[model samples]
Target: MTAHSDSPPSSSSRRRTAKKKRSSTPSTKEGMPSRSPRALSTSLESIQINPRTPKTPRSNDRRWPREDDVDEVELSLLGEDERRQAADGMGLEEEMDYVSQPPKKSVSSKDKSAIVLLVILYLIQGFPLGLALGSVPFLLREHLSYSQLAIFSLASYPYSLKLLWSPIVDSYFFRSIGRRKSWILPMQLVIGTVMLLISFRAEEYMNHPAEHIYEISLAFTGLVTFSATQDIAVDGWALTLLSEENLSYASTCQTIGLNTGFFASFTVFLAFNSESFAHKWGIPRLTLGTYLQFCSLFSFGVTIWLLFKKEDKETSEEDINIKTVYKTMWNICKLKHVQILCLMHLLAKIAWAANDAATQLKMVEKGLGREDLAIAVLIDFPFQILGGYVAGRWSRGDKPLRPWMIAFGPRLVLALVATLTVFWFPKPPITIAFFAFLVIQTVLSSFAGTIQFGGIASFHTRISDPVVGGTYMTLLATFTNLGGTWPRFFVLKGVDAFSIATCNIKAAGQQLSVKAAECVSEHGKQACKDLGGECITERDGYYIVSAICMGVGTLLVVFYLIPTARKLQALPASKWRVYT
Candidate 1:
């Protein structure tokens, strides 16, 4: 729990405490006394601004202010050296309360080993999530004849509805094993088991198209449901596993692990020829069952490996009640800033979704294949890592605002890169030019995206009320899904208008040709030849959709980013939050 005082402690009192603690410790080479963990913890706890409970008392101490009942900005009023000492003392074991100061929780090696095991177990579970979801579109397109829009619509359901059950995971625990681990381990087992079962179904259902679709949908839905549940558990565990000091770094490591799993399963392996595999296996027709079976086999292998891994053994009873869970969710809603930040996060993702949708279409229209898209994503990942690293480097100081500025200000660069690419892609001097443009755009997007997420990480952590961190993040996820989906919904609906307009224009041209032939017999051959192929009207509409969507999306980002940039720029360098 964070320590809060009604009034500021006197400088004399602070100096005396410092001197006494300093005298007890060994002197450094420079003759300055080292800081004690207790003092550092005290100072940090003093300024914690609990975002969820704003009515909680504020403090004047200089450590990195947590969002717990205390405010972080107030803590930045301290001298740089003091803040640095506090920050250094905070290692991976510290509590991350949005509304209170984080307490560094020290555990034995046994417990640490448990956390390590848990990480591995959860990572294994995350793999099939990526693979299954990523593969859905391809499977539907090839076997079910589902349109791109329909695939997008269908696969999006699980992620979009994650929040509905987030509370149950947060507050409710099993009576037997433990709240988090009990649920997590079993769920992992279920996923693996289901996946394995799904694999067998693939061979049996291939010939019957209707049966194939039904079985595939069921298996896919099961995977999504459990995958989402696993995500909840993992996120909660991540919050509880580390201490205040190491939370940032640990989270980064977690992200790396999660993304590695996600990319390998979803982005990389998804390109495999599952359709052909069915044929090779002598299946009469492609079945959804086969696809599930493949994914299940892979998932089961990982699940078996994870069952023996080290994981958290501790569980608490206080964490399992529905009433307690609702309280936590309600508490998260009480934090106004968290709500705003969630909205901002949603908006940012919306921009990204729009960009991604447009980019995929444009790439195909330009005659690029899936290989090119893969290369583009591969190139973008590094830039994102670089951006995250850069932001971490620049975030050391008393300035609380510097990181925000850096985070939100550069998004326009992404918009610019995306918009400009459309023009260059078509008229590029060579394919190399097209490749270069995409690579550059990918890098910029990655950089901006990294910074944006980094900012979110810091904000969420800083404002975190440890008890409710799970709920707060889940709510944030809910909003993010909403933001991402709304734009796509509208865009998909409007696409038909563009299609209809193009068809009408082309029909008009054909009518003109008929009229011309009737008026002049000599020109009939020329008119017929002109109308024989190459529908110019259709081409124009295609270009218009590409151009208009990009133009509009980019313009929207520009407006949104300007104020965000200005605010971020105004933040002081010293107070900028740093996460590794």
Candidate 2:
């Protein structure tokens, strides 16, 4: 458990307990004090955050990572005096690598092949993301209810949760082939295989998505899971592929490649698939199946190409263990600031939940063209980059949250504007003025999201403890991503709950079955439409839910959230540290 207590024992009491516990604890063969296995077990239990049920075992081990089990972060943290003690106590005079990282290869920045390889792999990774986050949701909105879309949204969860198992992927790789390859090759192959198989019935599943929602979600979830793993491996391998001199290229490649792939799969694919666009160009519509098969082929080709590519193995021979990583993460979580920050991340998205989850779909429902929607996104990309860059610059000072808070106000305004836009949308044969307005709205929304994310992310990077390395930031990010994810289901459900609709506008004499469906349920809506009823919904639940989100969010931010965020930012450096 997290070992939290508003009335925790005083420093004197804790020191006395530690002294007593150490005296009671047994000595190792080298005469170093060893923690009980029970303490480790307790730390393991803490991973699930049962803070109220904390075990009261206050030894030095609880205060810091012990000598023998210390990880890379703690290893580097050893001072001259501490290093001598650690070296003498652990008998580590000979193995220097255990105490330090190995030197990185100094590859040139002009290493074209390596850059190309990284770009291609990242591009492959982006396809599944686009398919899940971009392509699928839009398509489903046309035929399914918000409730059904909520179910389908589960496919996006694995990306957020990937960090939980990342250490296992990091540590347990087949040395024969290579650590990165053991993960990347298998993951890519599996992702390709899944995509290839799904291609067989892509159109069928999409056309009657409600009937196969579960199956579709499962398949895509698997794809995303594998892709997430692949991403971790690729990211880790990027260090090995590029020398310190050229390491900057890796992130550039990742950005360019992933964006290009996601753009092609989502915006380009949708534009080409639009009947209006295709007919205007005198071109045949692209099939979903063809796109899936093409993506699978790209995946397969990438796997094959990587099979021959060599990687520089890390000089440190010791492997990372999953248990150790989880324990480290749990210890970080046990911190009061970390816990509060995590909770903040989880609750932060509430104000914009409806805007994020329902806005584009609402646009689609409100007579916006898929092509036009794709175009809006297409135009928004540059602004996203610009927003992030500008926010990144602004977040350099003491208070990053100021930028984040500023962005939130505009985002909330956009949320309200989004709801109004949906309400005021003109019927089919959509006007250019409306389309231009929607496009402008989308661009601004994208910019707002970028700035908020960038500013908060800068804050996370600044405050995160180096003792845990990337794991600390990764933990925060997982919760941040999760905050946006889980509430979607409820927000979607709320859409139907808060709406007022009537499906009783039936043909003159076909009134026998008008009562079968009041247009509430998906099946009922279909049934109502089949009975020749207009199924008119005078008051959309989307508007009610959005208004509630904006009001609650604005109040929460002004009266509570912004102040709480400043307090968190003002916390002393000591509180952020999880280890001594």
Candidate 3:
């Protein structure tokens, strides 16, 4: 928006305006509660600050310039649209998109090319992540116990641990190659090489998992490490790649790309690789090696694309200091509110830990096919997307945590539904009704899960101070991931610890109680059957643990969590910063 005035400013008024501009603190550095009272009116009159972080100017995001932005020579370079806006406008806020900026393409054109590049980069990061997190677990569940799967889960920790090394990546780069691309080039290549190297022994690793679990875990950990490093570079690139008008698409593209990659690796791979699916459709099987090789080659393709299409901005040695980044993070963490939030993030996932980690495995043990599980997830994928979209919408505006609160109960309800579904697993030729039942539960589960995650993330985005936002967010995310992941191991172990099993001998017409471990493994259960008895769970530990979790979770959310979240969200933005 351009402003209009009838006459030029007098010398006295010019001096006064200059004095005011100099004395007033820039609002973007820290949101001061003391506004000039005209600040709101000034913002509305001109300068379209990015919607991603509202009017706040992030260290990375684009912001508009003020009174003294560009000299006359630089000013001459501005396009038709830019000159008109600058001529009539007076500088108000301290933000970034100064005069003499390059002409923006029409909004109709948007930034599709940049966004697509971002998607490809993120998709490259996600392919192996899904293989390790989703496909591997399903495959391993058939052979390994939940306790063992918990150990395998450690492969994902490299991602959770990446925050430790983020400052190094963010601070230092080979400027000639490009800030992000320097890391992206080698990281993607390494990721691809790791996947290819592991591909040759995929069958061997799976065939004798117990003997080679560490090798498999260590290999996948390396893959995740490179992916995490690539993630850092890509995220840094995104800050510059996105235009002001399409800034919001950064998160949207990430969600779409990551989930798309996951769907390909986990759902599509499982379906095509299924023996039943291949036999039913007369199609060739998709082996783990083939899938890994495909992912590897795809990563290579993206690496080649990056070489040609690297971002225009080169890295600056100006702001590259690892010590400052760490210090900034330490200051953010020292705040009382951050400490409390850290605690909340660490404790929040306890309720869903068992449900998330073990429920599907329980269903599989009761005879559900991995292919069927994949199909259910495939059908629910759209619903999950819809849920995240709707939740993202609902999470906007002042009260972002409301949808999170609403989503909480449904997750608990879905957990119960899953428990019942497993408890009532039907015999042989698993009917359509059974499949439908699982599908419904999974759909609701996906929707609730996505909604809850979106809501919390929105809250995170809302509260983050733009100055230290990247570091603050990374720290919070680490704790959040830690919360979810740390509990999964114990929950998996608990399921076995609390179980009671009995052997039913039909010939003797007697049921004899047996140790939980005796009836837990595939071989153990088979051994019980071979001894003229069928292994039956007298009391399943998963159900007991889930019930306890739900009950305890409900109380925590009601008495402590809901109130804490509401108060935190309502707190003044200044309160979240290190200094007033």
Candidate 4:
């Protein structure tokens, strides 16, 4: 019996010894449960954390159980937790040593080529792709019996809603030249070929003049279509070239290029055609076709030149293709700032078109013939060019205030001056009032145009949403067209068909006055009498309406754009994403 009792006590001592052995040398898997003391040590070690208190793990229920002696405790299932706590207790420097190294510089021959290609493509994009659209007003009035509204309206249609097809352009590649290049090359070639073809048939079509308006419109539609497409690709190309560091210079260059193209096409081309004494008169009917063909050929040639220059370069960002472009465009359209500007765009353009519809009519109301109007317009070209240059400089300048003043201040002041001049000087002294109005209108219009285009370009650059830049710009173009063209077409359908005098002579009793004056001053006396004799004439009510509309439109644009410009100025330039 004594032997049995001794054996039982010995066995109990052995079991205690085994337990002690297990607790002394714990494996990492078994060391996780005793977490409290280690956590306390960690809290003390970390300088960033509060040394006096342990962090609460969301709730009391989730808290580590309060133990009597964590160092002495041997937990069954909490081994992993204790190990993690121990690992965390190591010095931060050791932890940081486990972090990854920074990336190396990546430059290649291809990257260099890409930069060159981008700039060249952008520069080439500035030529006259759709000059015919600008000439539509004159084209219809000269060749077809169609009213100004119909021609402008039809011509504007292709551009007015180009956004609808922009997604397709952004998504699908033409299976030959890649996505952007595919559309660009073919369209360029087509524009050139079609312009050349149209040049041959220009006079035939004009002379036949049936419901041939549709045929002419069809031709214009093709031009506008390709032009809008080109704009999309070019815009995308521009955005791709821009970076935080060089965005200002890049944007300014783009703006200059665009305006240069616009002015060259509108002014320089006209001048080339205008040398009548050299037996090369730019008579619209004879020269329009050839000029367009030349422009188209030049534009296409440049695009092809870029094709050769950029063949080796590929976009490094996997997201540079059509799918990404569409996605980016979608996202940008949803942005609040973009939405606001778009709305303002629609509103401002409507007012602009309303006021613009009567400019030529107003001149006619002052007894000025078409030849006289043409001469006045010719003289005003330089002022317009100067205004464009000023606008470019102001927009590119650092000061928000100067740009705002150049854009809206000049526009509003000119509108007021023009209004006063017209109302106060209808028939004064050898067409003095007429010339004054012309000068003011020309200067103001040019300055206003500069502001409008530059401001829009700048705004477009700043709104760096992660949408396709090209598609976003196309939307801007589409909206601008909607704003500028639609309202004018709808409101002034018949009004622009006849000059102010021809339309209102019967209504105002000026027809009888003209016949009565035919015997006295012949044409001279009739001109004076039609000027409302000594009283201020109300013949140019349309122009007054237009000037007021312009003044109001200027106000609207200024209010909308100035705040945006200020906000853009406030943000760090580095934060801007050139490709939104």
Candidate 5:
């Protein structure tokens, strides 16, 4: 009886020990528990033993796939000391990769499309400038004096002052259509309509330009004002449209497009109006009015196209008030670079101003016809385009504004050479040699000017903060325009100051028998008689003006630009902000 009772208790204790062993031995399924208290305890213990095995290794492998994979293979072959050394090597490689690898550029298709649109919009911005500024010298040469034409420059005042209201454009925008489009579309339409209205009366004005000079000036001034407003919007849109990498080309588009539009308005328009060419080609004669209407139609068509397009909503939606605009403007003005840039703008283009104002008049005075002027300008257009493209490419890489100082030397040299041409070239009935000389000079100088302008424009685009793009760019452009415009005032005054008096005998009605030449005088001044209605003036003023301007520009470049460029090179690129 004692033996039977001992066997039963021992068998029961053995069964209990087997159950405990089964629970202690880890099974794959023990980690995955199902609704049992004993299984839950086993799962908890299993998790504690290999806590990092499940997740930490997998994440590390994924994070550093190549390094980790190589590490695992090497670790298996290595002893503990070797494995530790290999791990240290792997960490060093990872750090080097992190330091050396360039950040991936993520340019999208949308960004490309936006750049194309910017090119077109910039073209449109350039379209009216040809008529307003480019064609003014040629068109007014018949009826107005050089002084009168220079005074007409007052019309461009809006371009400089547009910055005053640029804050308004930035702060308030049409949310429905887009911040840029709302202003761009309406202003474009207005400019087109104004051009059309002026076209209806353009012939009348042309026939009697003297009588309608003030009226024409007033009318064109309104057009320029509207166009300047449109420019503000377009500039702001460009800031939002392009990525930082693509900003270098912004001025390339501006230079090419603007020159193309100017060529059409100035050179092509003059060609169409050429009496000799019109007679030869048998093309139907069109008045200036018709051309204006055509431009207006084009403007309207572009406006319609803009309606179908969409812009990115990258602009900040901060509650923009007048006070905010003022504060931002103030802050922008306070930047050290901004102050220097303003002074540069005021002086940089003085040489260009003298050349631009005096070149056409000099060519005309040298007996070149309107058709000759047109052909010269046409030949110049392609070179300008080429220069802009080359400069844009040079500026696009790691180096940006440094190329401007290099281009400055060539630009100044060309201006000086062109000034000398005025004195050396003979008057009307010019030889083919003279014409060739003029063409070559025009081509070379246009190229250099375009390059210089492109660099300045790219720099402006780079520095402008996107949040206040319109105000910022417009401010820079305004200074540039002011530099270009103010010199004209001095140039025009100098033209009159240096003019030599010539007497007209035919108008005086002096008899052949008279003892002395009866010179005609009007209002206590000798009446100067020359071909093409307006009396020809000597180019002495132009030479002096160009020399002085070029000298000052050279001095500034050496003293200001060289130092500034070196300083800019030393600074980190991150210090130059594109967006606020």
Candidate 6:
């Protein structure tokens, strides 16, 4: 028995001896066992109380190792100066976490080229729009009644509804040449071909406009439809071609380019076709067909150049499918900011719509010829350009849209000026004082408009997610266009509601017998007398509409716009992301 006990006898006895040895052994001072004295004591107490119980450390008594303690040890290894340097380095890393890095260098050459290309393409896009909205109405004014002209404006519906097919453009892209190029090249080719064909037929259509009005209108509608479709591709291309840092300037390019093209098609092209200008300048006269052909040739040149330019080919793997496109669009539309933006866009130009619709007629009533109107446009053009440039500069860097709110005061003042001008000068013999006032108003209004539009465009570009850029951008533009277009219906209806007659002198003459007594009974005799025998009728509709629009616009800016802009500004970049 003595020999057995001495020779580490049974397994149970050996286990007890091992436990005792482990409990007695001094644990390393650096480990948790040394630091947690309670855990060590608890183990010894539990072992003495019940040897049958398996010996285990008390988890409750064991303390976790502290980061500060570890850090202190690390610091102890270094000298005092080295420890101070390490602490400074750590602070610097923390500081960098919160600090914004400096902006990158100026835009690269490749990006500049892309911006130039975008501007040119946007110019092309604006051409058809200008011709349709500006020149066509002016050209057809003599033949078509005001109501008829308003009806004819329905041809621009394609522009406001292009979002219906924007997803298709975004989802499926040609892998060969490029996604945007494939669409742009083909659409440009088709549009140019159609314009060329129209050029050949334009003179004939103009000659018998009363007879071929429907056909001519249909042709123009087709042109607008194709132009709007191509716009989608170009807009998407702009989103992809430019980096986020340069996106805001995309609006500047668009505004300047679009306005330039508009000036060309609306003012310059119309001036070239003006009979008075042609006669006065002794310039060779050209038919509308010639102008159309010029535009067509320009389109073809642009298309050919774009065809040769290399674009980044999008892969099928990266492209969103149609279903995904719809899903993303739905998701985007659901955003709170997006909803507010859409509403703001829809209401932004409501204040100017009536003034715009009635201004031409008012000018005519005031004995201002078409040339006078054209001159006003020319005076306003430079200011428009300057406004766009200034706004672009102000909206650069970190906050591209914050400065836009400054335009509200100027815009409100302009709206008031417009209202007063309409009521103040609505008669013949436009005096020099009145003319100067009109010119000043036009210049200031144009400048303010350019700035407001530039800011809105930049905001749209900034918020649009690149994954579904075409659809998103188009939706924003569509709402904006609708705001400009839909209000015209109300304006025209208001004109009629306010008893503004569409004077038909010939019809009145037919109704009147040779006797002066018959003239008293003519249907439009009173309106003729009011207009001083001019072919227009007017009333106080302009003042009423202007007052209503201005009031509503002011209210919206105060309540809706200020708050929404504040909210948008408060959001961080992380919150701006919609897709994963």
Highest TM-score: which candidate? 2
TM-score per prediction, in order, is 0.61, 0.80, 0.79, 0.56, 0.68, 0.67
Off by over 4 Å in 5: 1-123, 174-178, 235-259, 304-322, 392-402, 454-474, 506-540, 551-580
How large an RMSD does model 5 have?
A: 22.9
lDDT of 4 by residue, 168-244 (tens): 65444433354357667777777677777877886565444344667776776677677667655554443333331
Give the number of colliding residue pairs in candidate 6. 0
Model 1, residue 372: C-alpha shift (Å): 3.0
Range of the 10 consecutive residues with the lowest summed lDDT in candidate 5? 41-50
Question: 1-580, model 6: which lDDT tens digit per residue?
Answer: 0000000112332233234323422223331212111100000000000001111221132332235435655765777667667767877452232233356569988789988998888677667767776776666654444445556667666766666676666544445556577678888888888889988878676655656767777877887788767766775566447654554454455555666676677777777777777888999765678888888898899988886798863222122345655675678788777887778777777667666666665555445655566677878766655775676676665566665677778878877777666566656656778778888988876676666655665665566553344446556656766766677657755654554434433454464222121121122344455544433334445566777777887887788776777677666644544553
Give the Å error, residue 61, model 6: 40
137, model 5: CA deviation in Å? 2.3
Q: Which segments of model 1 are wrong by more than 4 Å?
A: 1-116, 132-135, 138-151, 193-221, 238-253, 270-295, 302-320, 334-341, 349-352, 395-433, 465-470, 500-580
Which candidate, 2 or 3, would have the higher lDDT against the true structure?
Answer: 2
- lDDT for residue 363 in candidate 5, whole number 0-100: 64
Per-residue lDDT of candidate 5, residues 1-580 (tens digit):
0000000112222233223222422222332321111100000000000000000111212232245445555565777666556657777564344334457477678677776776677566555666776665566665555556666666756655665765566545545566678779999899889889989888787756657768888887887778767766675565446554444344444444545666677778877876766887988665688888988998899899999988765322123455655665677687776777777767766655677667667666555777787888777655655675676676654456666768777777777777777777786778888888889988877676555555655665555553344446545656755666667767765654554434323435542221111111121122233311222232345566667777777887788766776576456533534332
Clashes of 3: 2
Error of 4 at 175 (Å): 6.7
Q: What is the C-alpha lDDT of each candidate?
A: 0.45, 0.69, 0.67, 0.45, 0.58, 0.59
Counting clashing residue pairs in each candidate, in order, gives 47, 1, 2, 7, 1, 0
Q: Model 6, stretches more than 4 Å misplaced?
A: 1-120, 201-214, 238-257, 304-312, 316-319, 389-409, 419-434, 454-474, 500-544, 551-580
Model 4 RMSD vs true structure: 23.1
Candidate 3 per-residue lDDT, tens place, 322-420, comes to: 676677678889888889888887777677777887888887788888789888988987776577567778887899889888887888788777777
Ranking, lDDT, top scorer first = 2, 3, 6, 5, 1, 4
Model 4 ranges off by over 4 Å: 1-130, 143-146, 157-161, 174-179, 205-211, 237-261, 272-286, 296-310, 316-338, 355-409, 416-441, 452-482, 494-541, 544-580
Residue-by-residue lDDT tens digits, candidate 1, 283-320: 44434454455555655665566556445433221213
Best of the two (4, 5) by TM-score? 5
In model 4, state the lDDT of residue 479: 63
* Residue 245 error, candidate 3, Å: 3.6
Model 3 stretches astray by more than 4 angstroms: 1-111, 315-320, 501-518, 526-536
